[model samples]
Target: MTNRTRTPRTRYAQSLICLLFVWAVMGSNSALAELTIRITEGADAAIPVAVVPFSESEGIPSSDKISSIVQDDLAMSGEFRTLAPEKMLSLPSKRSEVYFRDWRLLGQRYVLVGALNRNGDRVEARYELFDVNREERIMGATAGASANNMRTLAHHISDKVYEAITGVPGAFSTKLAYVTRDSANGEPRYRLQVSDVDGKRAGIRLESKEPILSPAWSPDGRKLAYVSFETGRPVVFIHELASGNRTRIAEYRGLNSAPAWSDDGRSLLLTLSKDGNAEIYRIDIQSKNLKRLTNHWSIDTEAVWDHTGNGFFFTSDRSGGPQIYHKSSEDAEPRRITFGSRYNARARPDNDGKFVYYVHQRDRAFHIAKTDLESGEETVLTRSESDESPSVSPNGRMLIYATKQSGNSVLTVVSADGGDAYSLPASQGDVRDPAWSPILR
Candidate 1:
C-alpha cells in the first residue's frame, strides 16, 4: 500500500522538476514579437479555392487586404488550398466581373470575390462566394465594422465562406488564450495573452514577474480563468477581458490550479490540494460555494465537462500512472478511459461527444491523442515529442496545442482528423497553455 501511494507522488515530483527546468532555461532578453504563422503541413486533398484581391476605395487606409486575410484563414485550415492572387488571370471584385471559364481553367473549385469601401469612420465589405464547377453564386453578404477593425471583418467573411463550403462552421474568428514567458533585466516575466485563432492581433491580459499556467476560457468568451504565482504561491483568478478586472477565485492553503469552467459558466472545476492531497473540486463562481468532486489519495486534476454537461472527464493517477477518466456525475465512480499509454492527461471532449483528446506519452515523447468514446479506438494526433495543452476549437473541426519548434515552445493548429498543421511561433521566448474560446454571440 505504501509503495502504491509513493508511485504517483514520485511521478508528480518528477513532472514538477521537469517544469522547473523548462522555466529556468526559458529566460530570454528579447521583447515579445507579433506571432507569425507558417503552414507546416497541408492536406493532400485540400479543396482548391481562389480569393480575388478585393478592390479598396481610394479613401480606405492601406492595410492587410480583407480577401487576402480570408485566403490565409482558409489555407491555414488545411481543408482549402487557396490560389495566389499573383497567379490569377484576372482580379474581379464583383460577380458580374467573374468569368467562370477563367477560374475553371485555373483548376479552382470555388472562388471568393470581395470589395472594400470606406464609409465615415467605418469600413464596409461586400463579398460573394461562387461554386466554380456549377458557375453559381452560393453565398453573399455585406458586413461593416469600425475602420480599425478590418481584421475582424475579414475573419467574419472567412467564417461565412467556410461554412458555406463545408457543413461545419469556421473557427477563424475565435480567440486563443495563452501564456508567454520571457526574461527582462535578468528577471523572468510571464504574460497571459489573448489573440485571434490565427495568432494575430494579440493583446496581453495580464503580466507578472512570476509564472502563469493553465488558462481556460469561459463558455461565453468574455472572461478567462487561470492560475498565477504572483503571490509566491499558485492562485486562481478570473479575468474579465473588457473591463480588465481580475477577481481572486481560489487561494487555498496548497496547490490551486487547472481551472475548467462548467458548461453554463456558473462554476469552475479546480484542482486544489488544501484538503491534504491534490483533488478535483467544483466551485460556484458567484457564491463561492465549493464541492469536492473526487475523493482519492492519488492526484486528481485537469477536469473538463463532457458534451452532455451531465458528466466530466479528468486525469487521475489512481491506476499507478496518470490516465484519463470519466465520471457521469459528481458522486459517480470514474471509469478509466486511456490504457494505450502509461501517461495521459488533460481530456478535452468535442461538442459532438464523439471523441476526447488528451496528452499521451509514448516511450519518452508526449503527443496529443484522442479516444473515440464509442469505439474505444485511440489515435495519436501529433508527431511532436514535447506536445501538451490540447485545446479543441469550438466547432471541433480544428485543434490547437503547445509544442516545441526549434527548441522554443510554440502553438500548432491541425485539423481535427490530424491532417495538415500550421504553427504560431513567437520570435523570442516561449509560449504555452493555449485555450481555444467558444464562438462568440
Candidate 2:
C-alpha cells in the first residue's frame, strides 16, 4: 500500500475536452464497442437484493435517518441493485414475515431486515440477511453506535452483506474525495470535497476560485495531493490533515497535474508536459528527485499504481487512440490492458489485483467499465451517456466515477462488479474527478 505523505495546500473540471478525447480514441459508441470488463470474464451477476425497512428497537431520536443511509450505502456498491420500496412485493420485518414466494415475485435472491434498539446514550442495531431462494438466513449481526454514528453503522451492515454475497471484502465503509466545478453564465466555480463512500459526511476539504483537481488521499488517509490553479497555473501540492499545511511538490513550466501516490508513499507518479508533451514521471518524495518514466511524445497520463505498488497502469495515445497500459519497474516494456475500447480508456486497478476498472467510450458518450487483466474479459459497469474518472475503493470492491446528470457533473459510486449504483447528490455544486481513499480509521 502507498503511504501518503503530508505536504502543503493548493488548488485543483467539467470540460468537453474529455468528450473530444473520447471521439478521437474510439471510433464510435454506437458500434458494439469492445468493453474492458469483458476482458476479466464473469463476475457473479449483480446480486438481486431487497433491504426491508429497518425496525427501531430503542428510543433513539426518531430523527435519525438510519435506514435511508443504509439503503444509500448498499445502492452505491453496484454489485447489488437494491429493490426500491415501490418495487418490493413484500416488506418483511421478521423472519416469519418473510415469505419466500413474495420476495421471489419481486425477483429478489437476497433480503435484508434490520432494527434499532435504543441504548442509554447510544443505539444497538440487529440486522439479518436471508437467502430468499434457499429459504435460509445467510448472516446476521448486532452493532451499536451513537446517534451521530448512524451512518457509520449503516456502512458496517452493507460491508457484511457485500462480503457474504460476493466472497470479496466490501469497501462500502471507505471514503471518497472528488472535484466539483459549477459553471454559471460562463463563470466557473470549483470545490474539493470528501464524502463517505455512500455520499454521507461530506466535508469541504478546500475551496478556491481557481480549479482544484485530482483529490487523492494518503495511504493512511491523513493527507491529500491534488493540482491547483490558484497560482494561475497547474501545480501539484500535498496537504496534511494535522496542520492543514500544503506543500508544492511539482511545479513545472507547462503542465503539472494528475498526481498519483506510490503504494509505499515514497514517490509520486504524475503527468508532466514540461518536456514538450504530456508524459509520465516518478518523483521521490524524500530526495525531491524526479525520474522520467515514459518518453512518449503522444499524450501519456493518468498513471495508476497496481496493487503491489511495483507496477502501474496508465492511459496513453501511443497506440493512436487512448488505451490502458501496464508498466512495471522491473520491465522496460509497457503492456496494453484494453483492446476493445477505441475512444478512451483509463486504468483503475483493484486492491485485490483481480481486475482493472476503466472508462469505455460509445457513440459520443463515455461509460464506466472494467477488464480482467488476467483473462482479457471486459464488462460495462454503467450505461450513462457521459461517465468518467472511475476511482476504485481501497478494498477493490467498488468504484466511484464522475457523471453528468442534467448537464451538471456529479459523483457516482458503483460496485466494481457492477452491483449497486447511485449518485452522490451535490450539496453545493457539481462534482467530478473522484479519487477514492485507501482505508483510514
Candidate 3:
C-alpha cells in the first residue's frame, strides 16, 4: 500500500514537471503570444458606443485594465464602434457623472460606464449601460473577480453589455482552441492552445513535437477533440481543459481524423479508413460502439452536426469536385448543397441553421463563403487568397478561419454577412485550425 501511494505521487510529479516545461518554453518566446487582434476592416454601419474609462480605487493593481479590454472586445466584434478616452468629452465612471446632452451631441447611441473597487482580495466592477437617446439606464450590475482574473471579469462585463443591446448572448467570455506551429529551435514544435475569444491570456493545453489539427470543442466547451500524430499514426484524442487529462478515442488502420462533436456531446462523427476508403462514422464516446454513416468510395469527411441535432452537414467529393452535402438522418441519403463553386468543402452552419459556410474556390483563389439555406443564395464572405477551416461564432455574428497573408498563416474573423473582418496573427509562427468554443451557459 505504501508502494502504491508512492507510485501515484511519482506520476503526479512527472505530470507537473511536463506542464512546467511547457509553460517555460511558451513564456521564454514572446513570439508565441496570445494572438494579437488586428481589425483589417470595420463594418460600415457599426453601432456607435462609448465605453468610459473605469476609475480604479486606491490599493488595487492595474492587473490588466478592465475598461481597455472591454473596449477591445466590443470593437473586435465588428458590432460596435467605441470612442477613445481622448475623444470623450468627459470621462464618467458612474451614472451621475454622465451628461446625456454631451453624448447626444457626439452622436453616440449607447454608453457604458463602470468603476473598479477593491475590497479585501476581490475586485468588483460596478457598471451601467445606458441609451443616450432614451436617457435611461438599460442595464446595471456588479461583477467581481479575483485579482489575477481581471481579464475574465472584463470579458464578462463585455458579454453582459453585448447581450443587453444585441439580444444575442455575448461570446466575449468564450474561449478559442487553435494549433500553433513554432520551429524556431531547429526541430518543429506544435502547441494546442486555448485563449479568450479576443485572444488574450493563452495557455497551452497540449504540446508535442508532432502535428496537431482539427480541434473541435465539445458542446459544453469543457473538452476539445483533436487529431494528434504523437503515436506515429494519426489518432483522435479528447482532452479536458480543466484537468490535463486526455483519452485516445479513435485509432484505426488508415485514418482516424476530423472528430466533430454532436450537439448533445455524447458521441463524435469521425473519418476513418479502416473499412477500405475514407468514410464518416459515429462512435459513442462511452460505449465505443461504431456506426457507419457514409459508405462512399469518394472522400466523405469534415462532418458537423446541425443545430437541430437530427441531421448533419458534411463535405464530400462525390460530385466530381468537393462540395457540401447534408443528410437528414443516419439512414438518409446525402443531397448536394453547393452549386456555385467547383470546390466547396467543410460546411459549418450557424446555430439557427440559416447559413452554411465553407471554403470556396473563386477565380482560382480560395475564399470563405456562405450559402443561405432559406434564400438558396451563396455569397462569398472573404477577400483573402487562401482561407480554410471556417468556425462560426456562438452568436452566429462572426466566423473565424485560417488564411495566408504575407507568407504567414494567420487566423481571420469575418462578419457572418461579409461586412467587416479582422486578423489574429502570432508574433512569430503560424496559427491555424481555429475552432471557436460553444457558448457556455
After superposition, the stretches of candidate 1 with alpha carbons farther than 4 Å from their true spots are 1-29
lDDT tens per residue, model 2, 361-395: 87777898888877999898887788878888777
In model 1, the worst 10-residue window by lDDT is 16-25
Q: Write the per-residue lDDT of candidate 1 for residues 251-336, one digit (tens) a residue.
A: 98877888999889999999887776778899999999999999887888889999988789998988988999999888898899
Instruction: List clashing residue pairs in candidate 3.
Output: none
Ranking by lDDT: 1, 3, 2
Runs with alpha carbons beyond 4 Å of true place in candidate 3: 1-33
Order of candidates by TM-score, top first? 1, 3, 2
Q: How many residue pairs clash per model?
A: 0, 52, 0
lDDT of 3 by residue, 1-441 (tens): 377654643454344334323322332222454588888877988899999999889856766889988998889888888898898999898888999999999989999999888888899999999999999999999999987889889999999999999998988989899988776566667889998887777899998887788899999999999988888767899999888899999998867878999888999999886765667899999999999999865767888888788789988877877899999888899988899979898899999979999999999999999999878799998888888889999999999998878876778888888976678988777788899998877
Task: Output the TM-score of candidate 1.
Answer: 0.95
User: Which has the better lDDT: candidate 1, or candidate 3?
Assistant: 1
Candidate topping lDDT: 1
Q: Which stretches of candidate 2 lie over 4 Å from their true place?
A: 1-52, 81-111, 132-137, 183-187, 362-364, 375-381, 414-420, 425-428
TM per prediction: 0.95, 0.78, 0.92
Cα RMSDs of all predictions? 2.1, 9.0, 9.9
Supply the global lDDT for candidate 1. 0.88
